[model samples]
Target: MTVPQSELQQIVSALQKSGLTVESVEDGALIQHGESRVALFAEADHQGGVIVRLHLDLDLYVEEDSLPDILMGMNLLNQGLDYGTLNLDPVDTDEEGEDSGVAFAVLGRSVLWLPDLGVAELDRLREHLRRFEAEVTDAMERTLHGSKGLSA
Candidate 1:
C-alpha cells in the first residue's frame, strides 16, 4: 500500500472546493475549465517552500519552420503576464513524426510560490485561478492575433 502526498492532496481538495474539475492523480491534479484543460503539480523547493505549477496545452498548432515567429510571439505574450510563460514545442503526431508539417502547440505554465501554502492560500487561489487562466488566454490571443481579448 502507498500513501498519497498530503500536500498535493490538500491542494486538490482546495481546488475542488473552488468548483474546479480537479482529479487527483499520483503526484498532481488535472483540471478542466471551460475549453481549457490544465494540469497542476506541487513540489518542495530547495528553500523549504513549495512550488505549485500549472500547465495547459493550447489548441493552436503551427509548423516547426515557424519557430522563430512562434518564439517571438510567445516572448511578447509572456512580457504582458504578471508571472507566467507561453512556450511552444514540437508535438509527436505519430510514431515516426511523419505526415505532419512540423506540428507544434503552445503550452502555458504558471507557478505559485509559497513558504506556507495551505488551506488559506488555496482559498485565495480559488478566486485567482479564474483571473489567471483568463489573463493567459487573453495575452496569448492579443500577442498571437493582435486582438485585445480580456484584461486581468
Candidate 2:
C-alpha cells in the first residue's frame, strides 16, 4: 500500500522545518542540511504496514577528510534510523542487504538507512531528524565563530 500524499507532505514539511533542504523525488524525497544529505522512501509491506527508509548522503569537501568521522556519523545515523523502527515495532524489517543495502547509496557521499518504519515511527523519525539538524547547525556556528576568533 502506498502512503497517502498528505502524509508524505507532512513528512516533507517536518524535515524542511528541521532546516533540511527538501526535494521530492519520483519514489521518495531528498533532504540536505549542512554537511548531510538524505533520501527518504515510504512504502507499504505485505501486511499493510508502512516502511520508511532513510538514506544519508554525506558531503566531504576535502579529500583528506577523516574516513572515521564519516563512518562514525553513518553509524550514528543508522542508530537513529533504527530508533524509528524499534519504536514502531510489530513490523517486519527487510534485511536482505544488511551490511550493504539500498537503504543508503553513496556515490561519492555517505548514506544510511531506516527500514520498516510505520506512521508512528515516521513521526518519531521526524522529531529525531529535527534534533539532529539543530545540533549540527549549532556545532557549525560554534566552529565558525571559534575559527574567526583564532584568525583575528
Candidate 3:
C-alpha cells in the first residue's frame, strides 16, 4: 500500500511545524528532515510496510556543547510510525556511487527492525513523535531567545 501524496504532505507539514525543515523527493513520496543535513526516505511497499532510509553526509558531526549528538540521532529513528516495523540499511553509496556514510547505529544513528504494531500502537507512536518534535522545537526556541539576552 503506497502512501498517498496528501498524507505524506500532512506528515511533512506536521514535522515542519515542530521546527524541523522538510524536503520532499521522489515526487513528494519521500521526506527528509533534521539539523544534520541528512535525508530520510520513506516509501510504502506492496506488502504494506514502510521502508525508511537514512542518507548521511560523511562530514556531519555534532558539537560537544549540543545535546548528546548520539541521542539526537536515535530520536530521529525513534520518530518513525509504529504501525509496522522499520527496516534500515547501513551506510552505502547512492545510485551515482557516492558514499552516503549511512551506517546502522542501532539506538545511536541507524536502525533496522520490525515493530509489529497494531492500530493503537501506531497512534501511540504518532503521538510520541509529535511530542518529541514539540519538545525539540521548544528547546530550540528557548536557546535562541536566551542567546538574545546574552548579547544584551
Candidate 4:
C-alpha cells in the first residue's frame, strides 16, 4: 500500500484505484469527483517528508460589496477545517474581460505530509474532501447566506 518515494505517479494510481477520475497535469494531479475538482501536488520537503497540497475550486464568485461577508465565511470555515482552508482569491469572472468587474473565487486548500496518508491508501485524503465540501456548503448556506458574492 505504500507508494514510491516522492513519485507522484503512484499517488495518481492510488486516486484512480479509489474510483476517482484523475489526470496528471503539468504541475500536479487533478481529481474529479462528481462536480467537484481537486488538484494535488506532492514533493519532498527539507524535513525528509513529502509535502502534500490539495486544492479545490469552489467557483463561488465574489462581489465588491459582499467581500466582507465572503471573508467572514472564509474565516469561519477555516476554523472547522482539519488541514484545509477556505480562501478568497482574485479571478477573472469574464474570460474575455467583457464587462465583469473585480471578482474573487472561493478556494479550498489543504496541506499534509506523505506519512499522513497512512499506508498511502488516501482514506484521510478522501475524508478531507468530503469534510471540506460539507463545511463549505453549510457555511455558504448559513454564514454567507444572502450575500451577493456567491452564485449557484
Highest-scoring model, TM-score = 1
Which tens-of-lDDT digit does each residue in 60-135 have in candidate 4?
7777668876677567667876656787778855466555567777787877766644554377666765676566
RMSD of 2: 11.7
Model 3 alpha-carbon miss at residue 73, Å:
20
Candidate 4 lDDT for residue 2:
62
Question: Which of the two, 2 or 4, has more lDDT?
Answer: 4
Our tally of clashes for model 1 stands at 0
**Stretches of model 2 off by over 4 angstroms after superposition:** 1-10, 13-20, 59-122, 130-152
Q: What is the C-alpha RMSD of each candidate to the true structure, in Å?
A: 4.4, 11.7, 10.8, 4.4
Better of 3 and 4 by lDDT: 4
lDDT of 1: 0.72
What overall lDDT goes with each candidate model?
A: 0.72, 0.48, 0.40, 0.70
Off by over 4 Å in 3: 1-10, 26-35, 60-152
Question: Which candidate leads in lDDT?
Answer: 1
Candidate 4's displacement at residue 5, Å, is 7.4
Better of 1 and 4 by TM-score: 1
TM-score for each predicted model, relative to the true structure: 0.78, 0.40, 0.33, 0.72
Show model 4 residue runs off by greater than 4 Å.
1-6, 93-101, 116-121, 141-152
* lDDT (Cα, tens digit) per residue for candidate 3, span 87-132: 2334343545444333432211222221423455345434544444
**Residue 147 of model 3: what lDDT?**
44
Task: Look at candidate 4 and tell me the lDDT of residue 66.
Answer: 81
Off by over 4 Å in 1: 1-5, 95-101, 143-152
For model 1, residues 69-140, the per-residue Cα lDDT tens digits are 667666766788875677777787755645556677777888887676666777666655666677877777
Error of 2 at 140 (Å): 15
